[model samples]
Target chain A: MKANYGYMDGSGEYYITIDTDKCMECSEHFCVKACPAGLFRIIEDDYEDMVAEIIPNKRQAIKYDCAPCKPLEDRPELPCMAACTPQAIEHSW
Target chain B: MVTIGIDVGAKNAKILILKDGEILISKYRESGFDQAGVTTALLDETLAELKLTRDDITSICSTGAGRKAVTFANEVVTEVSATSRATFEMYPEVRTVIDVGAEEGRAIRCGERGKVEDFAINEKCAAGSGAFTEAMARALELTVEELGKISLDSSASVPMNAQCAVFAESEVISLLHANTAKQDIAKAIHDAIASRIVSMTRRVGLNKPIALVGGMARNVGFVHSLNAAIEDEVLIPDSPEMTAAYGAALIAAERAA
Candidate 1:
């Protein structure tokens, strides 16, 4: 199960993709701690399974909130992605 | 030379006209659905009041959330840059700026020259912004001003549990039904916002001589909450809402020169 968060705007497209299938296998939720903006959280879904989710309010303005970490030249590794031991998190810029 | 700075804020559009480093006039109007239209009308009205025309202005700069909507601006600056610039110009000793607007909150760490070294923003959520207090005030059947004033009289501290505005509204109503003092609820609301803002400020590293800008600065209760949370005296300009516009004007002056 792939969960997508964020939206595209006049500035650019930003998405934080989470592979829930891979996420469920992992016990440590590092993405929640790695996000500086506190935009990530773990929530129990309809299936009563714990999954990582993006805070609903941050979905629209992810571009601005993540702007500081975005680099102009080379793509830098994101802390949230790096922290995910299962490599379940991905960011599309 | 005359320069005009326009801040297309979420709730209002503020315009500041500067003539040779001195403020000539400042005006603010509610920003309706059409930000560009409101800004243009504001500029026209200000220019008319000062007996000046657009051509007479050496430069025009725009800042705030809808800054890009102002098509006539010579340049567009971010709210962080503009607010820090204005705050630093007024109080050179200010090293940190906490701006809580209607829809957003920002904490900026600046150097001695007012250049932003680091910053954090809470734009997506309304819980920590002025809108939270406004919503809570509506729930309490009190005006925003009255809410702030009444909060000062609160003797007991109440804690707000909700982190979202929607949830907080219900919490406020429940408190009201439970016969919780309105003053205590108001204080709780301010304290909640203050704690969120203080945590955001800590992200960029809090420095001394902090300045609080934006419309929230006008709320004495919120200011007191921030002061208590940060455990430091926070400086506020005469017109807290106009800081971004003033900074934009300063940038326009510099660019025109």
Candidate 2:
């Protein structure tokens, strides 16, 4: 299951996509520590699968929160994605 | 030349026609699923009343949530910039701005030219926005307007523990069953929203001469709650809901110039 967390408004679209299927196979929750803002958390989804999800309060402000690691001027692979060896993470902006 | 701003908000689509900073026509309608269709209809109605055509307008800027749906827009501005422009045009002294709309709440630190230096928004949570008030009003069997007015009658502070709007509705029902005063409950609802908004606003640093805009600005109860939370009365511009659209029109005019 691909879970996209974020929102779209007049400003722009900001979302963090996580593939729970790939996440389920992983024992190392590196994405949790990889996020500088501490936005990712381990949670049990409705289907009882333990998955990494964006924290409730921080989900709305990911654009600003993720800016440090994902600067537009000289962009590199996102910390969260680079930490996720399963290649389960992506960003929509 | 006439410039136009169209705001396709979550709850309403509003259009403003401006010429030399003077508003010629302003109109709004309850926004449904078809954002662009609804806005075009609203624009047509306003133009019909003003005896103007799209060609007569020098430029058009679309803003708010559904701004992209307005394909005819010459430009699209974000809500933060739109709010900043409108605030500068209306209250240049304002150094901070808090806008609470139906779906979102934002706190902006404004610069001398009404530029947004920084902003924090409550986007994913209904508890931090006007939708929470609407849910509470429905649970209390009162109109949204009536709930705001009725809350003003209560002096007692009732605490709302639920941070989610759906759970808050259950909390309201429980309070009602326990024979709690409706006005007190209303006040609690507004207070809860205010606390959430204030916390978010604090992130951007709430400066003096703060201005409040958006549809929620019209709620007197919310305003009073916000004042008590911040220990200051925020400035409310005329037609607070229209401020974003007006700001967009101003941006359109500047871009055209």
CA lDDT of B160 in candidate 2?
Answer: 83
Candidate 2 regions exceeding 4 Å error are: A1-93
Write candidate 1's Cα lDDT for A1-93 as tens digits.
899998654334579999888888888999899988888899887777788999997785565567545533244688888889999988896
Model 2: how large is the Cα RMSD against the reference? 7.7
| Model 1 ranges off by over 4 Å | A1-93
Clashes of 1: 0
- What TM-score does the predicted chain A of each candidate obtain versus native chain A? 0.90, 0.93
True contacts kept of each: 0.00, 0.00
Q: Rate the local accuracy (lDDT) of all candidates.
A: 0.86, 0.88
| Candidate 1 CAPRI grade | incorrect
Clash count list over all predictions: 0, 0
